[model samples]
Target: MAATESLPVTGGRRLYVQLGITLVVLVAAGGMLAAHRATLDSGTDRLAAADGEWLLLACLAAVATWVCAAVAQQGAVAERLPAGRLVAAQFAACAANHLLPAGAGATVVNLRFLTRCGLSVRRSATALAVKAAVGGVVRCVLGVALLLASPGTVRLPARVPPALLVLVPVAVAAVVLAVALSARLRRAVGRGFADVREVHRSRARACALWGGSVAFALLHAGVVVAVVHALGLGLPTGRVVMAYLVASGAAALLPTPGGLGSLDAVLALALTAAGAPGPEAVSAVLGYRLLTGWLPMAPGLLVLALLSRRSAL
Candidate 1:
């Protein structure tokens, strides 16, 4: 009787947490609209002067991230999922991702959606772990390959800024410290090894998993590169992508919602270190965020709310 009684309490707490995150997401979207440029931290002013065509390209690439995410989600599990609902869930999950630090919102939304798709809770959790681990591996591989293929492409700035020097060591140390201290994280790693074996049992599923993760990372990198071009900055595409990969990877270590402030800070410094003008580097970061985060948020929110109402997620 006691064990059963505690179940409701645990579930109720989870429900409350989900509701709180959803509320925060909705409020953020509304706030962005209401405050416009001021709320967005001056990105809008810079974007207004950029080339319209390139901006549109960035927006389109942002939209494609949903498709890639859905594909990867399917690959994470052996069982097939409903295509439409899967896409919609990815959309909504990304919107929620912006509100919670370290992608907690996105993970919750995906986990709930997988459960709704007739998966056992443990199996659904395993699938999530598989996807996360695969995604990380794919990102690192791509970053390394790009660097090896284009040696000397990433030129240093005339002088390394203090911000770059400070941020780099701090981010690396933070990640190392977090890994060393967390027993739970160690447990998760053990589970993730099980995840890899399960996900690779089917060749097709492995392809989808790897392919989707690759496209997802590349598409996001493309958005950043396009933004640089749109701003009329002459930074090489290779350096722009490298900067994004490094900054985003570092920012991922910190628990900031969608890498909001952390990503912005690190990205600007990274771009500066890559020799972009300070103002243009800032504008490039802002432009990419607007395209990827702000622009698609409303539709994502709507999809999320509807999925919630229908118990689809």
Candidate 2:
């Protein structure tokens, strides 16, 4: 009787600890954003005086892309999920991703949610792996294609080291290969490929899902480009796309919450390599972060809170 009585108390304490940790992380991220505020504000002011219509369009594109991404994940798990439940699972997953470390905790949370919704862990894991691979491959292909199509726009300076260009492809390929070879990875992904027969039956749907995912990624890149343009910088579309892809890929590897310092550094470096002035590029990147990262996080937090309340009730 005593043990049962203490269980809720212990669980409540654990929840408090988790909340404390979350607060600390948010505080740190807030500090980092505050440090960059002046630069972000200046860039915002610059962009405000430029093409407002494009910025609005970019915002809409981002929202559409986010929904498309959720749909792609749904398609990956279609065998195990109903459409409405899949949409809720994805939104809940997104909300957790905004709150957790490396976005991985969200995956665990998503898996649990899927189980509650009647999906097996193995099936959910396979679907997630496929979604990640498809999204990554599409992003890289688009990035490289953009760079190739307009070499002059994305060209590194003659004085810049050749190693940087070599690094991009090598790094991407290595990451993909490593994932393919892992034992644990094989178990998760092998099943998805084994479902190749089923996939073939729905080949057109699969293709459409993959295409939508790619389009969604492109829309995200467009948002970054619009943010830069709003800052009164005239960047070539191809170059902006290339820079966004590279920076986004690199940012995924960052340890900081939501890629804090790491994303800004990579974006600035990529932009500089692509012919933008260093200060201007850094400013633009900071401004983009404001709109894409911090602004969205607030609403995500609200979603998370509402979900938690509903769960508790």
Which residue runs of candidate 1 sit more than 4 Å off their true CA positions?
A: 1-24, 31-41, 155-191
**Candidate 2: segments with Cα more than 4 A from true spot:** 1-44, 79-101, 151-153, 156-186, 195-200
What Cα-based lDDT does every candidate model obtain? 0.86, 0.68
Candidate 1 TM-score, C-alpha based: 0.82
TM-score of each: 0.82, 0.76
lDDT per residue for candidate 2 within 119-147, as digits (tens), equals 77877676666777788888888877766
Candidate 2 residue 260 Cα shift, in angstroms, is 2.3
- In terms of lDDT, the best-performing candidate is 1
Q: Tens digits of per-residue lDDT for model 1 on 170-279?
A: 99999778877999877776677777787788898999999999999999999998899999998888888999898889998999888888998999998998889998
Return model 2's CA RMSD, one decimal: 4.5
Error of 1 at 236 (Å): 0.6
